[model samples]
Target: MVLAAPLAPAAPASRAPAAAPASVGGVSAAEWTIRWWRWTRSFPDGLEPYLDRDGRRCAMGQDDDGPVWFLAGTDGRFDARRRCRVPAGKHLLVPVINMYFHGPRLGENAMSCAQVKRRAAVNNDYLVSAVVLLDGKPLARPERLISRCFDPQAERDDAGPDDRRGVVRAAADGYWLLLPPLAPGPHRLSVGANYGNPDDPDYGRMLQNFEYELQVGDPAI
Candidate 1:
């Protein structure tokens, strides 16, 4: 009997990990909720003593304290015992440190500190990337790049062009790029994605023209 043509190999099936029980410091599939209230008694002047409730303050400068308390929670997949307590379901808590920033320009916004710390506490995974450009032009390669993440509230700092928190690459057509780790939510991207020849005064000037606004989340694009 004539043999039929060889059958094509079957495609492998995709599989998702099983949901884990919620714990105080581990990974779990259950959704966790965190409730926080401002300590009005201790912070009578509001979140920032220097800035008014309306988020307006003197340009000269003002004094303010960092985040009040940091809450730590887990999903019971990794470290079972940690600060805070939880039941058999997913558990979430606000970090003891305030990692958000609310100001005249910053507004009430959450930063990566809360997202990364919580994910790590629950054994979750996250990623960050950057897009570089010069004078609005994409680059082929970039030189001198750095990235890192921190609590803007605690640091009392603004995300600047030089801060190491995203990807940075050099371009062949005169554009430098930077991409950084980000969680679901609205994010502000600032880039110094260009370099100038030392002999050319136009060098580094393109940096002033670098700026971008983006949002990332469940429906990330």
Candidate 2:
């Protein structure tokens, strides 16, 4: 009789718990979304995490001293697969899909708080689905992660010369997830979302599918 070869071990299950804490490291989930956006815009064009094709730029805007790390979604209607190495013990903030509006920029009229909120919410109103998976296990109650309309101050660096800054009016709303620290090993995370009426291609349609293969420990290992 021929001897059978041993199969490889299965990858460990790394998932975001059903219920996230009220806050992580002194910051609320909602505020974390704002900070996530700021971090996304902190860098210039070539270094924006959202535009990073592969995960090499994952550390572009990271604060060396922060407790949480931010991940990005594609600009619009684009899919990206990335592999990254994250430090162990750091929480991960993922923006499943989100929208924001800041104004009084060049050639633009001032927008009221209500207007900003309304504009920011238009894309989300047509959301068809938003799915997040960690290690192939979906997160429970993804709708619970939706954020209410609120203003987020725009720092000087978060805006351009044509855009207003320093607490300028802004509003954002979308689905966001705060994943707790992962075990010091390999993990997989993916986000998929669809917005707009499929039948009408011109109706501000936006679709995104982002995949992240993460290693939550020293890459040298």
Candidate 3:
């Protein structure tokens, strides 16, 4: 993987655009849903992802000030760095690493939290790679925070309001990359992935690469 030159992301637009559409590059999220019906209904929640008209991918849920931007590619196409603010302490890092496929389809493909680290990584053509630097140093990889990564429809009936707090959007990129509680300080997170393969005769699409600058200290409002 090529190391992207460090850069800062632009501030988010004042007007919040609606959620991502069904197409990334040229692949249609809608068509993907119909073709992969068994899994699409529940995973990536069958919803379209956000896209940039100029062929650029933006971070989902991330604010120029802080949090995260959803649905960006993981192939380093997104060379700009992003900013995210979070309260000091333990928090999960949920990232969407691929551009072509969505994941964590519970019940159907054995997508339970028990399998995310292994199954979710390879199944459904999903690929994810991430690097987290806290206070300029790498921290130990935390346990996979799977249960917290979820969307509606596949939502467990027994889940309460508390469990729903961590609910991710219904898109293909809605998988979690666990990060242990962060110390009160500034940090950097780099993520990369290949959605599938563009040259393959069958099943080909774009990929993703994203970076984030985090300020973890302030308390969650």
Candidate 4:
């Protein structure tokens, strides 16, 4: 009987009202939007031997074209209207050393099936096998193709190196085996092409093989 009259029904516990959404500059929360932009550069020159000041053969000028692949997402898909452009006066060098599909256009690094098919018609006699390496370690042996994205061809330099030590190939698709996770430091990439016919005018050669000093972890483009 000493229960203090059942605590007066717990006094009907009070509750707080929900907060309204935030707004910016008189715009409603639902109408607010954000915009971003990026700039990049690329290189067309292949890595090859060059003469130094002392007239000796040496490899130099190894640098990367700024950010190559740019991925953007709002939820997870790309937002096309929020686009970016390359900044003016920005000259990008070859940042990563890997076999890339290059077309006639300056910034046309990735090629389409039609473009590769046309090129294959002229240079169809040989194949190029690329054994990609990062920090002197093997990554993948992506097969090189003729103009066709999936038509695998023979090597351009068969007798030069037997170990497949520097071989690079193109895939049937217009994609190259890209070296992965290049650190922010000095790095070197070597390629060996097996051109099946030495006397053929379309014989392949390891053109771009050099080291580049990269500034990794930089903000994305």
Write down the lDDT of every candidate, Cα atoms only: 0.23, 0.66, 0.36, 0.26
Task: Quote the positional error of residue 177 for candidate 1 in Å.
Answer: 5.0
Native-referenced Cα lDDT, model 2: 0.66
TM-score of each: 0.19, 0.77, 0.40, 0.31
CA RMSD, predictions in order: 22.9, 8.6, 13.9, 25.2
Q: Which ten residues in a row have the lowest lDDT in candidate 4?
A: 32-41
Best candidate according to lDDT: 2
lDDT of 3 by residue, 1-221 (tens): 23222222221244233233334335344322222222223335323222232212222323334222222233334444555556654333334332222343534543434333233333233222333333444333212222223344542435642323323323233233434456778766654333343444332333345555666676432
Question: Residue 36 of candidate 4: its Cα lDDT?
Answer: 8
- Candidate 1 lDDT over residue span 100-174, tens digit each: 122122225423443443322221111011222222433232222111233222222255422333322111111
Query: On residues 16-67, what C-alpha lDDT tens digit does candidate 4 reach at each position?
Result: 2112223323532211111001111121233122211121211122213422
Evaluated at residue 55, the lDDT of candidate 4 is 12
- Among the numbered candidates, top TM-score falls to 2
Provide the global lDDT of candidate 3 against the true structure: 0.36
